[model samples]
Target: MRALHIITGLGVGGAEQQLRLLLRHLPADCDVVTLTNPGAVADGLAADGVRVVHLGMGGNRDLAALPRLVRVIRAGGYDLVHTHLYRACVYGRLAARVAGVRAVVATEHSLGDSQMEGRRLTAGVRALYLASERLGSATVAVSEAVAERLKRWGVPAPRIEVVPNGIELDRFRFDRERRTRTRRRLGLPEGAFVVGGVGRLARGKRFDVLVHALARLPEDHWLLLVGGGPEEHVLRRTAHEAGVAGRVLFTGERPCAPDGSPGPDLPSLTSAMDLLASPSAEEAFGLAAVEALASGLPVLYTSCPAIEDLPAAAATDARRVRGGPEAYARAIAEVRAAGPGPRTAPPAAHHYSITRSTARLMDVYAAALAGSSPSLAPLGASPS
Candidate 1:
């Protein structure tokens, strides 16, 4: 089938990274469109021989791009249009329908009780989402929590499909040799306790809390901040103020895996970390936490619905902690005291494999193509 994937931007984030992985597993003649910044992921897609079109959307209110988007959809002759992120979901769904494409699917990647596009919830935003949601055939939620949030946002339950994010398990499996090499390459101290936090260095990620947590730990404990963003300067100041600057190492934005795969070059680095901490105040799905778990690292998270959904055996090493430096420090100390547990892929990993997620997505596509209207609602109507 011919499919076109639309996203707000092809930047280094969870949704974008997940899309990259999804494309590798999906068997379709697919192309991509980035509504705004065609960041590093564009290069990675091009390397993989995927067509990527960049729409120079000046800003969020750039409505002029709508006609261009509609043209792209029509010209591609796509059997289905799949959207990711909020901006893309709204505009892409509208464009698909206007272009006469019957099947439109969207993935809700980061909606939480606290935030949307890094902003707090407002009435206007909900109305906007509710309006756009009606145009799509199916709305894919990356986790049960996300699905629940959508229902609360007034999306009908039948329209929300819980398709958990998937990971490339083999790439993340722990390796002693890789640990040695990666640590040496990254200049991480030998035998020091490394607590890693992977994701965009944004305020929402709470990396500042991590730096503070590192300060309360032993001198041997160090911090590895993977990925980068506008908050780098602020985080550096935070690390310095916390007196853990020397102990903190920042690896600026890694968009693709070292082997040039769609995902980040995090697998090799995972081997070097003693533990992984995802202290974000809100997380719909914790892709990094799952990868760390798959890599066999103990995880301490504030809110990761994805990890919570895993079975006890798979989630044995992952713990939910309150959001604070003190709490995170205590959790890290406790996990350290317990020592590193098994470094093998958990049983739950299979449930979230990219292959399985791709199969489920295809099923969603088929259902949409079959003209299965899960529910119907007038545009801009709120839930009763």
Candidate 2:
């Protein structure tokens, strides 16, 4: 089927990178439209031979982009339109309908309890989201947590499909050779125990918690933050204040996986780490933790529906820690004392494989085209 994917921007964030990965695996003749900045991800799409159009939207209030998007959709004669992120969902769904596409699907990549994509959930935001959500045939939630959040926000259960974010299993598989090279490249000490936190450097991500947690650990326990944002300076300041500034290494936004880019890819960075820690109390899918598990690293997270949804036996190395820096410090110490296990992905990682997600998405597309909502499995049940 001919399809078009719309997103707020093609940057290095999880949703943007997920879109790039999905496009590679999806069988449809697909193209992409970014409502604003077409950054590295846009270039990556171009390299992959995918058509990407930047809408040049001035801001959320840019009305001119509506007609421009409609024209693009109409000209493409796409059978279906899939939207990602917030602004694109609200505007892309309407434009696709106006352009005469009957099937429209939107993926809610980040819909937390109090915020959606770092924006506070104001009344108007909910009204707009609910109103525009009706324009799409189905809303795909990245996890059961997000799906439940959508339900609480008044989205009908039947219209929401839980299609978890997926990872390329082979790409994340542990490699001893890669581990040595990556650690050397990052200037990590030979015997240092690296703790990783991956995501936008946003306040909500609570990366500062990791910085503080690092201070409580031994000098050899280092913190490697992968991603960049407003919190970069704040986190750096926190690290310096904690007197672990030299221990904290920030590699400004790296691609999902090496897209033949200059810097090291995420997989290489994962290879360099001893443990992955996500202190964010709020998480939709907890994608970073899942990727770490794929790399066979023990994970310490506060909230991760990806791990929580799976059977405990499936992810034995993942542990959930509560409270603040003290809790994280103790957990990190315990995991370190336990020493590293075999670097092999668990069953949980295979469950969320990229190819599996593509097949499930194709099912959602078929259901949308057939003019019916996709049936959901039991809340805790594994998706078939």
User: Candidate 2 versus the native: TM-score?
Assistant: 0.95
Question: Deviation in angstroms for 370 in model 1?
Answer: 0.4
Candidate 2 per-residue lDDT, tens place, 135-227, comes to 789999999999999999999999999999888888889999999999999999989999999888998889988888888999899999999
Tens-digit per-residue lDDT, 10-73, candidate 1: 9888788788888988999999999998988888888888999999888879888888898888
CA displacement after TM-score superposition, residue 221 of candidate 1 (Å) = 0.6
Evaluated at residue 1, the lDDT of candidate 1 is: 93
Clashes of 2: 0
Q: Which ten residues in a row have the lowest lDDT in candidate 2?
A: 375-384
Candidate 1 C-alpha error for residue 306, in Å: 0.5
Clashing pairs in 2: none
lDDT over C-alpha atoms for residue 236 of model 2: 91
